[model samples]
Target: MDCLNCFEITARLHMYIDRELNSEEIAIVQEHLEDCPSCECRFHFDMRIKRLVHERCTIQHAPQHLREAVMRLAHAPAGTYAELDPELVKEIKADLKGGG
Candidate 1:
């Protein structure tokens, strides 16, 4: 399953690395990885990066106020949560392109 050079596939690489991919997409990524060195390296790199980050970072509870704010927003209209944290999203997009 050779994937096109598209954003959807890029978005999915992170999901796949996180084990958040659904079954069908998982199968596609699994097949693609077997044949695609670039994608395979991307997967390995992302996995290693995340693993190292987790290993080094101490787990800390989210502040009570932050949790409460999220909880309050959870019940809001669907579009309310649509906005992404630009900085984090940029980091994700950059990492997907093999640029840390």
Candidate 2:
């Protein structure tokens, strides 16, 4: 099988991490990830984010501000959220603690 490039692997990252891809696709993605460190790092980061959300976000309806903050984080590039604003990260952490 031809190795998948970064674009293909990243494009399917969410599905791959969620186990939504079929066996062959999973094999292809796994092969690409094993060969490419950059994609692997991104995959791990996304997995952490997904796990964090699953662990913390149990409420049926999040507040508007919380939702907005999450959207901001979601749109941000990997590892850029804290660099963009450490204060915002702190605030979010505090809010999550209080809300929990």
Candidate 3:
């Protein structure tokens, strides 16, 4: 297979990391990554992000009150979200930290 250019390699990077590429395509991308420092760094960063999200995030149903609060905040004026219950805000912040 011909060596892939940076653009082509990057365009298919997610697929490569997800193991969706055929053997020939994988070999081409692997070769490009080996030769290109910038592309390699980007690939590493993307892989790290994918791993972090997969490991830290979970599938869960949001509570009705929390869902309602979020929907209200979403539709509210940007700076007007202060009307949301402070306790809920604190809970959300704590949950985000715990997940991270």
Candidate 4:
């Protein structure tokens, strides 16, 4: 395979990370990474991000109280206001603001 430029390698990086590329394409990317330090660093960074997202997105059971609150909201009649824990509200607001 011809030598891949940084742009080409980076563009196909997600596919490489996901193992979606064919053997030839994967070989090309590996060859490029072996020769290019910058792309290797980027590959490591991107892999870390991928791992972080996967870990965070994995399904886990919600807290019992939170589950109960959601059930209450689900069962509430229209126009009824369900009271939320003040700390939970603040935490939710912080998360929305990217501070959580």
Candidate 5:
């Protein structure tokens, strides 16, 4: 197997850690990390950071008011939102058109 370059491997490292890559891609990245000291160090560093963040972070549910506001905004008619925030309504319309 041809080892990928650090840039290519690192670009996909997040996907690898997330288990989002296929088996072949994972194997290629693993092989590259085994042969490349610098990339290996970087990979380990990123992994450690992610682990720390995961350990330290706590999921917080949105406050009821915020959730209600979002629900209202999401369900509001275009003209209704225009009266509240014309610019935001325009952006929302654009985003809807762009399939966001």
Candidate 6:
């Protein structure tokens, strides 16, 4: 089946190939692909790229110390969001009070 629009379909071809779209959206994509040859080519190309990435990429394990550091950071104080500045906190409080 010929693709309906080779150009416009390239824009969202990846998302469609990934099956990320809902059922209604899938129907639209299928209809378009069925009518357009260029779009089918683009979809095939995108699938090739995804397959290559899956074949070549490898996942890595986090270091032991990294896990421990995360545990400590997660247990830190409620107000301490991260890299907190004592001087900035004082400035914010002063601003809230309408004082320097």
Best candidate according to TM-score: 4
lDDT of 3 by residue, 1-100 (tens): 6777899899999999999999999989988899999999999999999999988896787767678887887888877634768888888777778877
- Of candidate 2, the 10-residue stretch with the lowest lDDT total is 80-89
Q: Name the better of 2 and 3 by TM-score.
A: 3
For residues 1-100, what per-residue lDDT tens digits would candidate 5 score against the true structure?
A: 4667788888988998889999999999988888999988988998999999998896766545545557887888876742345655566567557764
Q: Which residue runs of candidate 3 sit more than 4 Å off their true CA positions?
A: 60-100
Estimate every model's Cα lDDT from 0 to 1.
0.71, 0.85, 0.88, 0.89, 0.79, 0.70
**Index of the highest-lDDT prediction:** 4
Residue 94's lDDT within candidate 3 is 78
Q: After superposition, how far is residue 99 of candidate 1 from its true place, in Å?
A: 36
Each prediction's TM-score versus the true structure: 0.51, 0.56, 0.57, 0.59, 0.56, 0.51
Q: What is the lDDT of candidate 6?
A: 0.70
lDDT accuracy of residue 47 in candidate 4: 100
Tens digit of per-residue lDDT, candidate 4, span 7-96: 999999999999999999999999999999999999999999999999999997765666777888999999999889888777656655
Give per-residue lDDT, candidate 3, residue 80.
Answer: 63
Question: How many clashes does each candidate structure show, in the order listed?
Answer: 0, 0, 0, 0, 0, 7
State the lDDT at 100 in candidate 1: 31
For model 2, residues 27-54, the per-residue Cα lDDT tens digits are 9999889989999999999999999999
- Residue by residue across 1-100, what tens digits does model 6's lDDT show? 2333556567767878888877776777888888877777778888998999988896655445445556767999988866535665565566557732
RMSD of 3: 8.6
Off by over 4 Å in 4: 61-100
**Predictions ranked by lDDT, top down?**
4, 3, 2, 5, 1, 6
- lDDT score, residue 89, model 4? 71
Cα miss at 56, model 5 (Å)? 1.1
Off by over 4 Å in 5: 60-100
